[model samples]
Target: MLSISSTRQRQPFTVLILICLLLLLPTSLPFLLPPPTTRPSLPTLRSPPRRSPPLPPSSSSSSSSTSLSSSPLDPLLSLSTLASVILIHELGHYLAARTLNIKVSEFSIGFGPKLFSFTRSIINNKMNGEEENIEYSLRVLPIGGYVKFPENYNSSLVMEEELKGREKFKEKLNVEKNEKGILGMFEWLNEEEEGVVKKKVKSGSKPKITTPPKEIEYYTDPNLLQNRRPRDRFIVLSAGVVFNFLLAFILYFGSVLFGPGLLKTEINRGVLVTSEPIPYSPSSGILHKGDVISSFNGVNLLKLPSDVNVIEKEISEIIKTIKSTETGNEIEIGRGSERITIKPSLAVGRSYPTIGVSLSPNFSGVSKIKTRNVFEAVKLSVQEVCKVTKSTTKGLASFFESILPKFGGGGGGGGGSISGPIGVIKLGSDVIGQKDWSALINFAAAISINLGVVNALPLPSLDGGQLGFVVLEKVRREKIEQRTMDDVNAIALFGILILSVGTVFSDTMRLFGK
Candidate 1:
């Protein structure tokens, strides 16, 4: 049997460094790849015409600014939101453990040096009046948090420390002697004399009393996590993700019902140009930012069938029109009051035909709908959670799917939009800086859902991984060796850290538009 203390010892720094390097190798690939101009061209077409019609420009600028600039307090607010999510996650586990009559030794937010700490004595009526002293602490780092149980500790070491702490507490309570100079000296002398006189006939003789050392007690409560039934352990392990989902649901429900309602946008105009295109691409230098693409190949975008997939349909139609023509496709864009027409053809890239531009749905109008119907709100929240979870799961899967091939000499990588803690904070800050607090609420809910989905992945060291172990134990009808499980967990944790670092690197790259 391996004690949890020994199992949690820091892993080799070299091994972690190696893993991080391996994981981050893909992120450094952009630097090695040839620049856009130097890359081999797959398909090319003649330069197209550009015309600005004598018409009033489109005033399609919405309230939201496209700038991603950050304010001073934006990062702080984002960090606070992240901390709140983590705290809620830990609280889920803590509450579940307590509900199952499990003794929690500590509940801590964050890691590293402690900022504030306190001990709470909780009386468990089911444990024969046993008082559980749980130490709760807030640390400096806001990265993560945890809940600890006595079952995870070395019994002997814990007992020794408890005894030492108790002794120190008693020493603090007793008044110091001889600290007041002459007055204190007089009090000490009087106390010594009184002690000697009370002993009787003990002049110049000290009466020594010795008591045997107290025996240390170990906690053998059956309610300890490892001692509990497999089902109970499963609940405790899965509770974190469950709480994350619940938090997302609550936020969505509150926002949709009580807040400014849900934002409903109709894309009756055209797709908005989100960012600049890569250099030398078809749309490069031609389609400027804030341009509304009103039509493609003489087809009006407003005439397209409207639905949830309308944006995707429009994009698909645009691509189809580009590929269908060798004489270049006509593109009508609305920029302020001017109606501009540009003929640009698509270029074949390493993967697919691309114009090297990003586009999003251009809203014709925006409205908010508030409903007092509880059932409607509940339905909407549930739908939102499920949709987010499904998309997050797919995105996570695709990211790995894309990156795994890079390890096998595959040229391209990084398919889906992935963000780590740092990326999320930056995004949250940007939303706040834009003064769109409603979007921030929705962003928080989305983040919560993402957290839940990621933690529920059974790739080791996560909640889902732990739940898998419990199931395995139940099937085997025996417990796995703690050392073996610890080793697996350590490896998995290192992998997670490497992945996090890689994501941060990716986020940084994206921030710089690399």
Candidate 2:
């Protein structure tokens, strides 16, 4: 063996030791450093789509009485609830007229001209000021409401109280106001032969088709509503609007009180820490499917709040805090129930933190009894729906007036908007991404309002429009000839056609993202 200096031998030994240590450093350091702090995996989290609310009781009318039942298929909406909305709306008009001691000539659902009508007068029954004919009619158009008043209504007066300057259900006796409105009834009495006027042989004969023809006179009491006390006439006229408003409110409340107990929401698990580097997102370095996430970032999943508002607000804050923290946020998560700290290292902009999987809500939250307090729930729900409806209406109008125009809304061959089944499904997906339950509720409510408004608009051919003409005659004091009425009806029909085509076209184009 070649002999070397003692110094050279020691140096070679030192170099060999350094290379061995370098080889084992990675494996050794992991054991030396404490694992990213973590907590228990909360497997109980759930998303809204997982829960399905109970369906309403089916309508109980025999034959075709139950509208929704007519169809055997279950649609996106429960047929029962949707049908109930229509029934209740018409009922509002009927009940309101009954309250005021006013007689209804007929009541019908849907719009357009009348297709079927039946009339009847009460004989010897008195219940809550309802003393006369309970007429029920169905019009040709099946999308609206109609009520024939005994006399013209003027809502400016309600001697006791104005219906908040609105027309609502209430009673009024012509009272001592020989004021043209009441006097006209007296004048009506004058026009009839005394004997014919006193003709009371039969019971329950229709008040409208009474006695001998010679004794009666048309417009006998007409004083043009001008001579009546403002309050008196006002109350009578306000009844229609009041009834409609109430019906809408009831529908609003009913949706919440008895609505299905499912929301379209997402199962979002992300780091929620205040002092980490960069924001923690589902696709960030630290967030992973196996890593347990908590409100404290790496600690615990949040316990959902009893109050929806608080839950939303709290979650929002947690997210903001986590995002604002420094990049490479160290989060504590429980993987396989083993608590460990996960350093969600940053990538680009702190957006993608991942363990590699798309998550959905597992229906695992405590099953809540939907709407324990009916009244409170109803009130909240109605407000939510109304707000949604109003906002959506504004958005729709803006979309047509502004957005559409900008994106092909400028008339000629406008890339019209449309949403077919595919588009509608996409809408639901977008909704889940955008907001929580409240937003979903509002979306539902807004759709209902839109349906109501469209049905109620007094456009040509629409039921409301026909009713508008009926109202205009009384308000405008100008009689429309049958020919003129026919012409208006024709034009309105055309308008409806145009609107339908445009709507469908727009929906189709929109689906194409035009």
Candidate 3:
């Protein structure tokens, strides 16, 4: 019976391992396959466009090109990037606690059983003859990390005991009146106390309490997280969110400054028409090559004349609206310097209208917008981060609103609406396969921003939840009972478990095309 129970417990981990193996193995196939003998020729019919001769490859360029061509199934790079970002977030909390003189008992990356661990002694004068050892560990699972602190009541009791012992020693030495003075003013000590102090001073012994019974310092002796001021605790709680946001902003800045050329338009031109009209198509006579499309169905193509922001989004919306319609639509084009309006009729038996003209694949007449200086990049990055944050917040709210109703209805049609770990891995694999640094970097930045925003939410089991408890304690001017805190934490854990299970189920359904 026990064996059966243990096997059941291990099944989820076994399945997870299998899933990871399946997801990663296919990506490595390209590495095993032979390299191409020569560059593949482009498809004919249009007569492939002319290209510039290849430049000589330097060492750095060669390595980068190789990386670009590497198999998309290689999960190492993406996984490592994610792990590093999470580690930095946790480090923010650790650093803040250490800065505030609060003792952190353990610092660990990941969850579950410890895979490896090491201890480091922290020697400080405030430790009161106690040795402070911090244990750093890496755990089996890489989902998240934590910094553990001594229990508040235990730490307070130990500190009170230590203070009592110090007071007793002062009484024994008859130097209670000298408490206000520096240690060097030992003149108030009686002969016996003076002799004892001299012998100890000569021996370079640590400060001792001679009156009370001797006691060994325990784990609770050091000043702990709860002993810090409220503001300091708040900082410690919020530092992870701050670090995640900082990482996201840095990634955004890098993607803009160093990524592929940003899509833009020429000063007075729109998207230049490139392809000749298709035969018997809606645009056969009305549309022609070299016509720049400036608007579609009464909507202007450019939201901002000079800025490239929203260009892709507007274009996508326009295409979606056009494809959804079953009738003709108006298109405004720039021919030379003249603006002309044309009505494109729907092709026979097709649902959407067709102009039959193709946009320039190379963006021939359009401009590539690149940051000219670091200041502009920084400013743009900030704006991008703010925009992402707002959009993510709204999305999360909508997701919750949609899912909460399904919980009671027993419905199962949200498979495509949300993503879990499996979905994320699949998406990451796709991005990696594309071998585009800009896309990968932008994806990473989005994930980082999501992490920051999600963690900032006032939900139980999250950093913001901890901050909420701190705020409650401050308001009540009393510590919450340990039992109550435990109950809250347990409830939070259970809620997370339910959410995770549902999300994983949804992801699986999507994976199987349900």
Candidate 4:
């Protein structure tokens, strides 16, 4: 039977051998390829409030102050740095006045009653007008400052109005028709003189006495602000904004060249302690305050793999994973010389992972910047001005949109409230303590930008507001009625006074947590 069996029909011995070889291959495969090495367990995420350390004091290098993230709220306020922010804005006005040879009577640093002040000089009587020279002083309010230019009291446009009205009267009967404007303009001037009427002689009892009236001098100077061309006046009026933007740039450049500049590179490349836990969290303990995070979830945050060509793409992926991850899922992280697996706990109210710690980026050579070069400093200064103006517009737009409502007063809840000087000081101190100079520099730039923007708004009391009037005159190709514009300005001024009062009230209300 074995000799006659076909090739397809296997013998029992051959079938048994084939079965033995198949079984042996499974045991020998391990010798060809070894098993993967074991990975170490990571620290769990956890921390308690009592275990948190007290906040460290800030360190200011020179008078130029920049701080690390002292508080989340600090970066949100650009208006609170009154000295560096608001004072510099006023400097713009003063310089602009000087540039156009316009006389500035007073410069007030604050809005309310005087805190302390002194006049730069005694009265000069430029126009010899009834208005005496004002001795401007600093006010208790530290929010803003102003420059008083000559003719600001009357606003040059006002003088032209009186002259035009009188001239129209002179031409009414002889040269033109219906050109006298209002019929009763003469009544306004003559009402005061009516008191000194000459006595008329009665036919029998009184002799005619027409004594010449004593000459009353009205202060007039044609060469001053009244005589300046609208274009020139506009230049002077617009100069303050120009100077404010300029100063903003200079400060910004100084901050960049001398202080910490914006970090253009990835944070992992910089000097930082990634292990500090985020505040008021439960995971603070499982994560130590000193350990540096080398990688997150088995992927190194330092160098994203070659397949991840762009850093932003990797970051997007990481964020997506963080958002999708569930609480019971284990997080694989690399610490200094150790691999740790942590089971992420769900944070009560957030969509993101709550490791309860914030990491600082490493920055080298922060203490080595210098702002001594004249030309380079000036160039950087200019760039900064442009940068700040652009940034201010962008940031404020978000708040106005109610996208994240933070500041107080709004159709939305975002107008959290205005943070005054106390808030800014607290922010400054907090940042300095954290040693985050880059943040501080950016903050200063932001404030300067805000100053420039607010000053440039076309409001009656602001520099831009006055500029708007000048533009109006240019379009009309003639001077507008000063009284009309002045009246409009007066209303505007009142509105501003009310706004100031509101701001004070708002600040007070916020202090008491109302």
Candidate 5:
């Protein structure tokens, strides 16, 4: 029922161009944007380092068992997983609509031409008596999906059809009543007594009840979504995001309870210096590739609370010490069995002060551990989802905050970076190459949460945007003009398409840069 206009149909080419621009723009950002005129002279603390690339196994046997060579199919697997996530999102909308007895026109995965399609008649218990046909379809493009509701639900043509259907239902009821004879007559009389049917009699004469009611009213139509209550509309609009979150939680719980289990990184000793510092850097002569830093300026790094992951806490403390360094700074290191202390003179007033060395937790190894029971799995999964949701919300808020200023010619948007579909596929491929299947599951869960968070944003063309309109209608107590709403949605959709292209392009450039 939702038709694409000729102008809208030609947007794919424009989208392609945008994608190309996005892909190429990041690589050219240095030349396109002017350098900052000022810089911070003081050292600042930052979050812990991102996970390092997976290390090669030490032995050939370990390599064969723990790692896999990169394959051509890696991208395909990643794409499939993404499609599955999108499909589940659409399904959520479909289920929610059906639950509310709202008629849905089509449920589709992907865009463009239909690869496959079928229609099924679903019987709604509240339909006041019949089935509505819904089309399920798969389209050629694997980019995204949608659940379509009839665009002209309130049109005269639709009202006419509904009238005919109601007439037929009334006839069916009359036939059943006639078949029941005397009992049906009593049922009709009871209906008249209860005000279900209007009755009239001459002053003193007894009223005569017909076998069938003279009129059948109060037959509510629950088929049109727009005609539903605001609460129902909100539920339908928000169901996709809810489903995405639920899927992520399920994946996390399964990974912890039934799959390869959740991964736990055991920290051993202190922070391992990943690479030696540059020749002229502050840590040049003071640190080496294998040095394990045990303490910073007399603060013991290994002493941590029982309930915390020491790696993040230790790294935070180390960074704090380095940022707060004054005239003298000392680091205690463990080299084999020898305890060595070194004082490195860090350069001041050079943006962020650093020891100029790559560092990570001195991890003994990674191990898979499962929850003791289903209850534990549920608890852990909920915690993981909550943690991820919190971090994602902060990250999204920070990204927008950073980029918004840049839009007005202000600086510092460089920190608000993002990746699109291509980036996700590439990340999945890397996980597959590492053959850390458990990590892959966790990655999928994180992606699922990310999808939910993005959709939940109050941005145009997203689910949240539609929800906003619904809320506005409720507050105003009047429906927004259908044409106006359509135009807004069309414009928003075009903008999003352009953005997606750019994101894809940017991600491609990043992939190649790596």
Candidate 6:
């Protein structure tokens, strides 16, 4: 009956193997057999345009450009990339625990219902009758993941018992030696003394006593995380944050080193003339498309403040100057290599001065921006990561500030806005629609840095919260009550659930334009 049951289990394994083989067979057929004769090509069919023609470049092209650049896999690719980073973050904790000889029970990616799972024995000792297994799993959702260690690792008493047992073994060896005669004592001293004493003894004397070396057995408790030094525990808890920051740095550095392109805006290059001049307006034919305004009136647009903010201020000043002047202003524009001067005529209707041609705020262009060496890339990448971190920190602070009042006594009419999973997906889709590789990479890096920062916030049910507990334990020199910790975590979990649901609701409303 046992054999039959075992065979029944093996049948499923056999079937699985056969299915896998069959699936692989077609893929391997090309290599296994000679190339087949070429088949006749089918007639190609072309699909008609699904949308209207794009507007002229002079008008805002954001919508049309996005439509043209978008790819079907953008959302899926972004989600997968995010999942990969989250997995790395979990791996950091898993590795740290394993390095300290703490047994991790499970390492799982994603949350909720498990889609697939497998277990492997990391350590097995038949003689000692000891085995340690780790289960790895994948789940249906890709929001977050975790690495679980043994729940009860407080093994100080077990260590004490082991020490006492070793001492008892030594005492037993000593007692056994005493039970023997003087010959046994001599044998215990050295092998040479035992042999000499045996030769000295008369024939047929009591057999020389022999005492074998005591076998000192050793055992290791796999559940060591709780019993480990506070420093180790702290490191294990903080490893996830460290790995997340590392991932951000790597992504930023790689993007700068080998990015597809970068968006750049050169100052004093003059605004781009986007359209042909309108008739019955000043400088209708004089200033045409592609003209770069080097100087407006007497002010040189090329020579403005060096600081970015100050430069923007100066540009605003130029616009104000033009609007204030009722008469036409002499504008020196750079057209190719030639510098042409034209005066924009005053508009017939009341308001500001008029220039017939449409002008872009800035002539921004995309250019490759790779570093010459890795060191330079690393330096720049670090700066970029720092900048993004600061911005995200500020944004989160603002978000909390806006939302906190709603739950408090002071009622605010406008509640704070936050992007949930759905919102994030929409935002990611828009970014991917830009079809700029540098933009995509930069966005990913920013998200990674934000994830790191969020995990490091001192809130319950987070890595930082775990670190906070470790710090308290270190300061108090006492283990916090397990029940209290569990209760606190449960409350945190509940709070998170409420927040997630609210965010999801908000995201749904925003998605459906409600």
Cα lDDT tens digits for candidate 3, 1-514: 0000111121111122223434532111000000010001111222223333332233543356323554744466656555566667777788887887777777877666889999999786666656778899888866446667655454345546868987876674565436544344455667777777767867888546355433433334336665566687789888888988898788767755775423222333244455678897666776666555665555555433533223433444555554555455555554434566656667667545656665532232222234758899898888777866765665566467656768778432222134555555555565566555554565566667766776677865567776888899899998665435545755764575556565556556767877
Error of 6 at 453 (Å): 1.1
- The regions of model 1 sitting more than 4 angstroms off are 1-6, 9-71, 142-144, 152-220, 265-272, 276-279, 284-354, 361-366, 411-414
Model 3 ranges with Cα > 4 A deviation: 1-67, 126-130, 141-144, 153-222, 258-369, 406-417
Give the clashing residue pairs of candidate 5, or none. Answer: 19-501, 22-506, 23-505, 23-506
Runs of candidate 4 exceeding 4 Å displacement: 1-81, 108-144, 150-220, 223-227, 255-381, 401-426, 432-442, 490-514
Instruction: Point out the worst 10-residue segment of candidate 1 by lDDT.
Output: 29-38
Report clashes for each candidate as comma-separated counts.
5, 49, 1, 37, 4, 1
TM-score of model number 3: 0.55
lDDT of 5 by residue, 1-514 (tens): 1222222122222123223333443221110000000000111112223343243233442344434456899877866666677667777888998888888877776776889999998776678667788888887766446677764333444446556777875676577568874234335345546343333332444445333322312224556666678899899888988998999899879977876666554445556677778678777886777666666555565554322234544665576566555646565655544566655455555544567776666654455657659999999889878876765665566456666776687653323235666676666676666565666676677777777777776754567877888899999999775545656767876665544555566666777883
Query: TM-score of the candidate numbered 1?
Result: 0.65
Candidate 6 per-residue lDDT, tens place, 81-187, comes to 55576677777888888777777777776666799999998554432445778888887665446676665523344446556777765776577568875445455
- The C-alpha lDDT values of all candidates are 0.60, 0.38, 0.55, 0.46, 0.60, 0.55
How do the residues 1-514 of candidate 4 rate in per-residue lDDT, one tens digit apiece? Answer: 0000111121211111112222322111000000000001112222211122222233553334544444555533333443546566556556655555546666776555789988765344554433334456787655555565444233334345556766665665234224433332223335444322212112233322132322323235442443467877777666656665666566556665665443222122311234565555544555566454567676766564322123334444544565566877876667655676755555768645655554433222112234556677677566556554554454344324442332354334222123333333433444434445554554455545555675566776556677787888888988665445556665765564443343334434644566
As for candidate 1, its clashing pairs are: 56-337, 57-336, 57-337, 57-338, 58-336
Off by over 4 Å in 6: 1-69, 112-115, 124-130, 140-144, 153-223, 261-368, 411-417
| lDDT winner between candidates 4 and 5 | 5
Task: Estimate TM-scores for all models.
Answer: 0.65, 0.37, 0.55, 0.46, 0.62, 0.54
lDDT string, candidate 1, 220-318, tens digits: 568778678899989988888899899989987886787655444444445667667778877677776556666665556655564434554467567
Q: How accurate locally is residue 294 in candidate 4, as Cα lDDT from 0 to 100?
A: 63
TM-score of 2: 0.37
